[model samples]
Target: MAANVEDFKKRLDEQDLHIRESWVAAMKARIVRGELIKCQRGEGVNHYKHCRDLAEMYTGMIRENKVKGYKIIDTE
Candidate 1:
């Protein structure tokens, strides 16, 4: 029983790490995309839209992972 518990804990830790990595990648993508629009003017509307889209995508991914029985640790 102890071994099984340890194995389960390890798997949960791995899944949490994977989720963290995915979040980092998503954040980097958002930053890179945002930087590409730095020289443009009158892009407030587009920028807001882009950010919203990325936010939605990131949230969707987290929700899907949760539905798959994975717990995302609140590292905040």
Candidate 2:
């Protein structure tokens, strides 16, 4: 048995997540983080930590540039 194929498909459809859209969202997030690092700063004790974290996130996205999910009906 495929274990309730209808239920599985219903759940999957409910999610309605698209891989390309997810990747684009991630890219936009990275761009915002980069903009913060380059164009904003704060006067506080944790300012350095905040900036470092942003930089790390921006670079980390470079290594992780893929969206993972189901690929039904492969056209390739």
Query: Candidate 1 on 1-76: residue-level lDDT in tens?
Result: 9999999999989998877876776666566445545623346767565566655555565554432325548899
lDDT of 2 by residue, 1-76 (tens): 5779988887777556566666786877678676765644563566666576666666677667656565567789
RMSD of 2: 6.8
Off by over 4 Å in 2: 1-8, 11-15, 18-21, 33-37, 40-51, 72-76
Q: Which parts of model 1 have CA positions greater than 4 angstroms off?
A: 42-76
Best by TM-score: 1
Error of 1 at 17 (Å): 0.3
Q: How far off is residue 50 in model 2, in Å?
A: 9.0
In candidate 2, how many Å is residue 18 off? 6.2
* Collision pairs in model 1: none
Each prediction's Cα lDDT score? 0.62, 0.67
